[model samples]
Target: MEPPVPSKPQFSLPVDSDHKATQFRLFSLSPPHMLAFHLAWLSLFSNFFSTFSIPPLLSLIRSDLHLSSSDIGRAGIASFAGSIFSRLAMGPACDLFGPRVASATLSLLTSPVVLSVSLIQSPLSFILVRFLIGFSLANFVANQFWMSSMFSSNVVGLANGFAAGWANVGSGVTQLVMPLIYSLLTNSFQIPTSTAWRAAFVVPAVFQAVTAILVLIYGQDLPDGNYSKKSKRSSSTGSGKNFFTVLFTGLKNYRGWILGLTYGYCFGVELTMDNIVAGYFYDRFGVNLESAGALAASFGLANVASRPGGGVVSDKMGRRFGMRGRLWGLWVVQTVAGLLCVLLGRVETLWGSVVVMCCFSVFVQAASGLTFGVVPFVSKRSLGVISGMTGSGGTVGAVVTQLLLFSGSNQFSTQTSISLMGLMMIVCTLTLGLIYFPKWGGMFCGPSVEPISEEEEEDYFLLE
Candidate 1:
């Protein structure tokens, strides 16, 4: 007996008679779904803390290490390089191994490197530590895989939006709290500012380590039999290669490249905004590091609102209308916002610059929400690969933008810098629109899928 062919697994929505009542009670009381949601959100928070903590600390790192602007730029490049490589490798890995194992492993690995950031004294050492941190930052890719798997396709956009939006809150938190934490430690304990910044790294590192443990203890493994079962049928019926073969072939599709470019542009803009805005504030307004951080934090907070709002709108409008429409809208908004920043370079009045930045952040984050919302609808089986490819595009975009920003022997003035970035966003937006427009009108109606239950919805949201 060929190992007693495993009984075909029964399929049904994982709901019980008490599910509605339980879901209602959970939402009304303390739902199990809510617990899962919080855990999912916390995973993103841990990931975000690791990723965004460096931006506010950049100035302190530069000053203490006696490093040049180029050195600061290189640190970011190292991190993005790590992310790029991680996506290329881990995207398929998630498909093979499942999200739970990959996410937990990556999160656990990141903790030590995060703790080690404080120990580095030399520029090369710092870059090395950052590269290590970046390599572990593969958690984000794993998290996206988890999200796509847990939630149904209809609500995947909203789920992804909420998770990503909340994750951005980590950036906001770093901006608001890091400066205050640094100031208090420096004054009361007489800790050197560099060491205080190290504490910021240490705290998040500990949190991530703890999160890894919790995930291992409490997180459920995503179902993997779906792909395996499908692949077996395909092979026996002479339909196609195994899962890996299909995954690789998916890459050859033109649609993948178009999606990748779109992701790249959005990622480039987001990284530019998150990583460089503080420097822009400092340069343009002469705000102290603390105030500049607070301003950046404010942008992150604004994203919390705008991001989810964008997702809700996308769901209501349908994918093509929702996804493409938001892309065009974001392009226009961001272009105008970027132009305004260029025009108002180095605002003499601090408040004026703050207002402009607040407005700019709304558009920036809206674009982010819209871009990620469309990832799952492309294909359920290929979500991990597609997400990985798109994510890689975003990383490339960031690398290119960073290169452009820091390029040339001549130092760029604040006005010229802002204007150039603005121009780039415009070109990128146009390119994305031209490539996506015809496809956009057709995507929403192309297929129909099951709707996710509230419990599934919560699970999906957290996965991202």
Candidate 2:
């Protein structure tokens, strides 16, 4: 017998026609929906933790390895550069192999690279390890794709934001935890400083491996079931699009490219900040390593609320005003974030800088949440591909920003470089003005009077 329609949930949570959950239930572990949520975020969390585990210990690593400033900048660029390639490939992989298998495979493959950090001897080894480990971030494409698969359009923003936002906290958590681990090894265990720093990596490496295993065992590709059991006729996530079709269709879509560029500034800037903020505090303010790491942690920890807040607001705006509202909301919040970033760079006093940084974290991370809020709607047929493109754009942006603005050989001061990044953010945000939809309109214009195309019709069925 067909299952009865799910009752309207009490707390604004409801089930969609596809049986996907509409409201988040944080503590639930029910299979398919909630279980997938936990595994997806947790796995990504470990990836983020491992990816950023080194930054807090940079001083120790720098001293031990004798890394120069130019070497440091290049290493930072290498991490993002590695992510760019993996994230681009991850989209089609999700479309073909399903997010569960694709995400699990990538995490497992890269977890060893995380472990290899303990073996680094020179700047080249450090850079190469960082680049290889960056591939773990490809799971981000799967995380979002999985959430989009399991949640209805009305709440996909919230799902994507919460998963990614919570996962992103790993960056902050690593900033705080890595120093403690290093300190424990050196001060308590009496391990030598050089050995202690290397030993510190074992924790995140283990954490990454374990989480990948959990995801592989427990996670689901869609609300219905595992992708392997899905019939070929199923319209669920990761089923219909072929690899080349998904890749080319997503690439051909102008809207996806625009989102990619905009996301580059918002999420990309967030990544660059994660890479440098601890060192920025240590160098500029003369704070000790532990204190620098703690301060930097605030920037990443803001994702706990700020990024999810952006998603909630985007869903609300989309509900009320449709795609036009989502676009306007994204543009406005991102612009404000850019302005705050500029202010953050200009603040001189440490306390003042901390305050500004906190505020900047709110808007920038929220802008990331907002970017994904719009991503699922761009092309349902090419959802994973578009996601990969935007995700890769973020890493590309970080790499470019790091190279041009904050590089060791650059003439600009760190403060000046930060301000320049904010300015670039503002310029990139204006591009949102160009995004429009035939059914829901755009930031400044009404829907087109021209007849709806087949693509528009498909979107209407999903969105309406």
Candidate 3:
């Protein structure tokens, strides 16, 4: 007549004495964990590459498309808006269809939209294409869900962080590569500045399309079987609940909503920075296009170390402090980020701003890593939907921050004000560090933790 012990999740990898996978090694995960990590990061990268494909080249795009400053801001808004909607839908889609199917579909579906940026000749058309291209950004939901299933909650933080961190480098990679492509096309190939920007879209589209095919052909939803094959119920009945009910369950989770806010501060800021930094440097400091992009790429590139570092910190801390450790990581990084944004606003020099911006990227992207450290725990049932709820916060944050601080005719002043917003929101979300969100509950301060279940995975839906 005793209450049953809650089960723990297992996601360990096979290893040999030498540390190379007994079979093959790629993207850092071992057998049963391999394809998931590989496909997740690669597909996530494709989406990011396509999503931010326009930003680094905004100067060229603005001139070529005859877009005014306001038009450029609106284009960023449109793109963010599209991502918000898609994140909302993709969360549920991933829950129902599995990450593999949903992700592959996302890449293939958005590839043409990404490629079609080549055809835009007017401001309205450019904005429309950018909006459609934002759908690619929703792949993060699938990427997280996929990693969650592939690894145990013990290491889920590291897995999620590493996957996202590396994937997010796409933004930085875009900044570096786009400028080079532009230079090559214009200088080497003798293509017109106007025409060369259009051709640049082809590279990302090709990458997106190829990754989609790879994921569909070879990716597995869970190690045991594919989502459709492993799951007993119809995909329509994800988490064994009615679709609307599952969604409502996610909607009602107040913690998930709060986590979404946290994501907004870290990732929302990252997205906004990705779009505006190039312009911020150009307008405020009078840097040339290539120079500005190179500067912005520093922010993007920091994800290579900062994000995964945050995840590793959480995992190590969780070992000592339990769930409180994870919350501690988020709180500390975000609080630092809030402070950094304020510093960034006050600094006047370009190099000073760049230094502050790079520092800010580290904490914000780390906070993003920490936020997802809590995501797969939101529901043992609907990780996809819950991830959607939280993930949607990033895009929402970007849009709101963009509108409130950066979206006006006076760009310079607006950019300064937006940092204040980041500071304010970080303050609001800080109390969540006091919360213990797991179903088994957690400690508020010290090193208390939760036990893992090796039994059946409970009917949690895989987003592939």
Candidate 4:
């Protein structure tokens, strides 16, 4: 059955103006904004749900496929490897075709892969399919890119965080719920054990397919319409070559690299955790499938509050402290996450380890929120490429961190790996603290921004 429709939307004054603005509650969204926001998270939820689907079932898949722990680690790499390049491509696609088309297209393409997990019979086939399935992970770029397009810089951080946090809530949701679905299908319905795990993928596939159709029907590329239509009204309208040119131009900026790499520590850790957390519990505590999945879910569950809280913090920081507030929040969260990871590595008890990990999750996810808080403000001209590259950093971090630690090890000993990554986070945090732009004047200087009036959609990004 289809979902119920929401109440009618109420419009408000636009996001940017030189005048004092009226305030509303966070996420008190109306028609078009509300529609775009929900649809973005729906697509992201389905995408990551598919991306991490195998992790919750990792123990079962390992036993069924006769795979080893090292094999699983390699499979994690395969999953992240598929995302990095695809994300780079998907970002520009969002810019050229519009986020609606990019998001729906990727989701529809991935639904089949979600279903195909059942067919793998060997280690090679497992990695191949896992890599192919990773393509769906790029849908997040579309999600945030779409949110960045719809909202103004003033609250884009919060909008980005809420959309991302809720969307990401699916990871925890999948880990929490998928096993129960598998058990029900296997035991109550008398489906074969092997068959039930495969059939479990059907839920996410069907959900993704239906979501694609909904987005196409209702979601908008811009606040008004598609790129072509909006370009006619934009001061900066152009052809396909112009879009790439603008995208590459944005890529040339170093601020994106710093944000992207710092993001690598935050979201990179999130992706790595989603892939390995269940396995960590299974191996460390000798827990059952349900307990391990729930324990691992603690890492992602923090997103429900952590990511939104990060956005609100960044927004409020910007309000009081200007651009430095966003950077300061980013620096502090990363520092906290690093310190927590260091502590997490030292914890020997089960609940103690879980608690440390959950605290680590909050700061890591919060840092991700703060990273994007700086993203829209980086280069509005090249927001698509900037977002894409920044998004790519997460996969890069996952691939590099995993390959460095688990590449040849037969077993997944997470403590040393955790400590190593924590050290890396501290280094990145220090670099963030030292970063400065002389043109902007000082370590904490605000951007020299031009005032933008409401109704004009294109000028929200200032070169200052």
Q: Which candidate is the best by TM-score?
A: 2
How high is each candidate's TM-score?
Answer: 0.80, 0.94, 0.88, 0.90
Question: Which sequence of candidate numbers ranks them by lDDT, best first?
Answer: 2, 4, 3, 1
Prediction 3 TM-score vs. true: 0.88
Question: What tens-digit string does per-residue lDDT give for candidate 2 at 1-464?
Answer: 99999864332346766677877887887777888989999999999999999999999999999999999999999998999989999988887778999998888888889888889999999989988988888899999999999888888899899999999999999999999999999999999999999998989988988988898888889776677777455556545545676688888888888998999999999999999999999999999999999999999999999988999989999999888889989999999999998988899999999999999999999999999999998887778889999999999899999999877989999998999999999999999999887767799898875657766666664432
Q: Which ten residues in a row have the lowest lDDT in candidate 2?
A: 8-17
- Cα distance off (Å), candidate 1, residue 389: 0.8
Per-residue lDDT for 198 in model 1? 80
Tens digit of lDDT per residue, candidate 1, span 1-464?
A: 55776664332334333221111111221223333344555776777777777788788888888877777778777776777878766677777665556767888888898888878898898777776777655665666666566555555556566666776687688777767777888898899876788876777788878887876666653433334465567678987434675477447545556656655655556666677778778877788998888888887777677765655555555544544555555455545655654544545577786787677677666666666666665545566777777777777777776767743233786556656766666566555444342333333232133556767645443332
lDDT of 4 by residue, 71-127 (tens): 887888999999999888887888777889888988888888888887888988899
Q: Which lDDT tens digits does candidate 3 get at residues 368-414?
A: 88888878777756678889878889999888877767775654584
Q: Candidate 1 has which clashing residue pairs, if any?
A: 26-31, 264-393
lDDT of each: 0.64, 0.89, 0.79, 0.80
Error of 1 at 82 (Å): 1.5
Clashes of each: 2, 0, 11, 0
Candidate 3 global CA lDDT score: 0.79
Global lDDT for candidate 2?
A: 0.89
